[model samples]
Target chain A: MTYCVGMVLDRGIVLMSDTRTNSGVDNISVFRKMFHWAVPGERIISVMTAGNLATTQSVISRLEERSKTPEERSNSLLELPTMFQVAVETGKLLRETVQDTQSENGEQGKGRFTASMIVAGQIKGMEPRLFMIYPEGNFIEASFDTPFFQIGETKYGRPILIRGYDRNMSFEDAVKLLMVSFDSTLKANLSVGLPLDMMVIERDKYEPAHEQRIEATDEYFLSVSSGWSDALRTAFHSLPNFSFGQPGNG
Target chain B: MTYCVGMVLDRGIVLMSDTRTNSGVDNISVFRKMFHWAVPGERIISVMTAGNLATTQSVISRLEERSKTPEERSNSLLELPTMFQVAVETGKLLRETVQDTQSENGEQGKGRFTASMIVAGQIKGMEPRLFMIYPEGNFIEASFDTPFFQIGETKYGRPILIRGYDRNMSFEDAVKLLMVSFDSTLKANLSVGLPLDMMVIERDKYEPAHEQRIEATDEYFLSVSSGWSDALRTAFHSLPNFSFGQPGNG
Candidate 1:
């Protein structure tokens, strides 16, 4: 399992994904799940994938190859006219990748070779957009009702995002929010681990305004991890003790 | 879907379960998920279930009836020799219930007619025991390293339990901690919801020392719910913002 999140803020898009992948608990591996393409000052697109590694990698490879040789596929990420088109192309590749793998593996593996992705970024004049692409090639763009998209082991980290996300928050705060969300997931689940990949695409920049890979030893991340735990404990203690009509109760 | 947690603390055992049960997002109903029986000074057993309502209800009804009249089906919970035996009996009953339902529904229903449960309580001389019963009739008891069990929609509430649980904490604190955990689950998942059922069985007592059903308007629960949102927001702000070597940041 994987955990990746992409948020559309007033400033830009902030995306974060863990690098852990595993066939089973014992056979763990680290693989980058975040991919990006930017034509300086023209358009920027970022994709974070979760699901069968083979399917995601094949889709990414196809995306990369098609962009370099647009005449072959024509749906090149670099040539996409808008973020919507980019999402459509990415979703199409993901669906084709899953179907191709499944057809080889036969009936039992039909749904096994599938993936989900979060696509985010902007074109020079268009507003930043965020979308969650499904294994079936369909997608939903984030809006005021849902300003963020998360794929993979999303539940463990969602309550924090539901509570902390603010459209007007700064990019730094957005990244910080994602950190806490990811940290909650990491601490609760074994599949999502450290060495997180993060990208901040400032509105209209067409390039990563700030990018960093947070490792287990990253000081700021460590503080956020340990500090959030402490803060939670403090917060837990601050809640009024439950009173079931006990003698010391209200 | 459901969210029910059973925890073992030094002073006693605490169990909490949401009352929401849904066949789909639009078809939701309230149903009690917590059941307990007390022999006053002999033994006290509590069961919290998550899964097919038919299977769980069947298992509980059989347990209840068999205990009242032990001649028909012999592994009656009340007549069990120890807490372990009670758990074994419950597991056997659960497995039989699932198998019976599945056989009637045929092949496509193989895994659907299943349920998981947390069984907790104590017998007069033995220590309190907690077991998580699976649909397969196999079960595992909670131990020092794993002092709690949560079934159905468990992920969202697990981190708080992992961080805040202490075997030595008071029943009030334990209930408080569970309220926060349930609150998190309720906020994140619609299937696990309001009007929580909670019961605490103190050491050596065969009856519930405290039992309460917290409704949507319960003041203490309201405070815990809204207060936790504020507390979490505060905690999120308290954590250090990410520093990607920004000149004014690091």
Candidate 2:
């Protein structure tokens, strides 16, 4: 399982993904789920994937291969006119990969090879765009009312996002909010592990503003995890207590 | 759908349940999920249920009916010598109820009529106990390491319980902890709704020490919900920001 979140904030886009993939409890491995491509001031795109590892790897590799060949440059990420086009083409590749794998493995494997992705980035002239692409080649873009998308192991981290998200918040605060969300998921589920990949894309930059790998021993991540827990305890203690209506209690 | 939680602490026990039941989103209604039976100084038992509402209602009704009849009183909740016996008997009744309903409806209804329960209480001379009874007439008791059990829509709220649970905490603190857990679940899910039922049983007392129905307009609950959100935002801001490694940024 993987847990990834991408936010389309006013300042830019923040994308975070955990690097844990498991076939079973004993067969767990670390696999980077975030892929990025940049052509300096022309275009920048990042894809965060969840679901079938094989399918996502195939789709990503095909995109990379096409980007390198002059003959396929028209359909490559580097040449996509807009982020929406990149998302559409990425979804198509994902669906085709799943279909090919299913046919190779036959009928019983029909739904076994499936993957979903969050595509976010910008072209020089257009504003930053974010989209959640489904396994069936359909996709939905983020809106003002719902400026974020999460995939895989999402429920545990969702309450924090619902309560704390602000569309106009700073990029620093956006990263902080996502860290809390990911920390909540990490504590509740063993399937999602550490060594997180995070990218920040400032609006109109057409390149990554910042990117980092948050390992288990990262000081700032540890501080956020423990600080959030302590803050919750303090907040709980500050709440008004339920008064009993019994004799001498109220 | 429902959300119910029960915890065994060093001081005693705390149980809470949301009052929502739905066949579908359009068919939601408020229904109390907590039931209690007590003989004052003899014993006190509370059952918090989740899953099929019809099955749980039938099980509770049967227990109540048997407890009222003089001839069947020997096998009733009032006659059970220990909390473990009460749990075992409750599991049996739950299994019987599901089996009867399925038989009446035939093969297509095999798993449609099923419910689970958290049974917590104490008999004179025994310590307070907690058990989660499955639909199969089997149950597991909570241990010191895992002193709480939650049923239905449990994942969203589980992280708080994992981080905040303390066996030595006061009953008031325990209630506060569960309020946070339930509030988290309530926000993320539409199926778990307002007007929660809470009960506390002090060890060896054999009766409820406090009980309340928390409505939507309840001031204390409102404070906890809003305060928790504010505290999280503050905590997020207090964490160190991720510094870019470019020139003049560090």
Q: Pick by lDDT: which candidate is best?
A: 1
In terms of lDDT, the poorest run of 10 residues in model 1 chain A is A66-75
DockQ for every prediction shown: 0.60, 0.46
lDDT of each: 0.89, 0.87
lDDT per residue as tens, model 2, A1-250: 8999999889999999999999989999999999898889888899999999988998998887754676655537988777888988999999899888888999788788899999999999899999999999899999998899999999999988988899898887888888889999999889999989989989978788988888898777888888888876666666666556633232
Instruction: Give each model a TM-score.
Output: 0.95, 0.91
CAPRI-style class, candidate 2 = acceptable
Native contacts kept, each candidate: 0.72, 0.49
Where is model 2 more than 4 Å wrong at Cα? A65-75, A99-107, A246-250, B65-75, B96-111, B246-250
State each candidate's clash count.
0, 0
What interface Cα RMSD is found for model 1? 3.2
Q: Which stretches of candidate 1 lie over 4 Å from their true place?
A: A66-75, A246-250, B66-75, B246-250
Candidate 2 lDDT tens digits, B35-131: 8988899899999999999899989988777546666555378887778888899999999999999989998887889999999999998889999
